[model samples]
Target: MSKVKLFSYWRSSCSYRVRIALNLKAIPHEYVTINLVKDGGEQKKDHFLKINPFGFIPSLEVNGDNNQKSIIFESLAIIDYLENINPEPSLYPKDLIDRANAIAITESINSGIQPLQNLFVLAEIENLGGNKDQWAKQLITKKFKSLENIMTKTAGKYCIGDTITIADVFLVPQVYNAYRYGVDMSQYPTIERVNKLLEEHEAFKAAHPSVQPDAPKQ
Candidate 1:
């Protein structure tokens, strides 16, 4: 491989998922910080749009011989790509059934809960003349309560059976967004507990938004 590069937006939850996975796999990759919030997302530019027609952040570029390449968009896909590169110390279980279940777990809430509360979705909700803050808080609380129920079935030191699977990576960022919008985490003690433990892990620590170069001049 020539080099690995990840184009990312720090505050984006999807980017956070890829960051955690790359760190866990001990991959060396340069971070290209894209400005997601500045002037309607530089990601939408024609240059970048070609990279990902969807024009979303968190695109992973795997450079290899002859400029031959692989590109992965979507946080979960990038994580799976990282796993394929370094399978030792596997984040995924070997049993096919176990792996299937694991993928199911991550996809469940990642699709279920996150979309309804995204930045763009939230803005749309606000534009509809509803109380955005109140609606966000309400929906988040309900979704988390649902998540708490599902998580209790298989949470240990992590979200799924003691391993720091992709689910955990997905969970932490979602909760972080919850807190950002003033949702009281007190209602979800289990989620809070997991995040506290995960935050100390090297991957999560390195991936934290505060540590990102583009996070605000301080």
Candidate 2:
């Protein structure tokens, strides 16, 4: 097994998703905190930029073969790499169609929803003299409405049937963002239920933002 190190911020939804994937796969890793909001965002610093040119959280550093290091940025790419290397207890379905469905659901959150309401995007909205909260409310509500309908069909004990897949990894973190932005989850019963169910899982619980090592001392 290679050494794994995760560069993450405690409250980043992307970071949270990767954390759950690592814990769910029982991959041993070291957590290196990158305080996203501290010192005008540590992620923008040269040190972290060297690791991720995009200066994003949740960059996974893998060390193998004479301790040669390879870094993967972007949440889905990191999760895919992890799944490829650690195939036991797979997070993706073996069937081709089911795998596509899983990736579809994952992308709906990872790309369709997250980018519009990302911290950087929100900041840009504010700078443009737009109301950030209202923007988030509108975008998240619209996207989650689509997600809820998708989940209604795909979910069974977990997203895309009874087995936990990459879809669930993406789901839980976005749900956290939903509540944070005060999106009315009451309308999305299936999504709400799945998020609640996944939260109870040991791995998901361990990866929650509040419990992270770098979480605010509250």
Best by lDDT: 2
Error of 2 at 202 (Å): 0.4
TM-score of each: 0.91, 0.96
With a 3 Å backbone cut-off (N, CA, C), the pairs that clash in candidate 2 are none
Error of 1 at 56 (Å): 1.7
Error of 2 at 166 (Å): 0.3
Model 1 lDDT tens row, 1-218: 45588989889888888888888888889998888888888898888887777887799888655787767788777887787778855777666765676676677668877787777888898899878777777887888887777677767888777778777878888888888889889887788888889999988899988788878866
Candidate 2 residue runs with Cα over 4 Å from true position: none
Q: What's the CA error at residue 111 for candidate 1, in Å?
A: 0.5
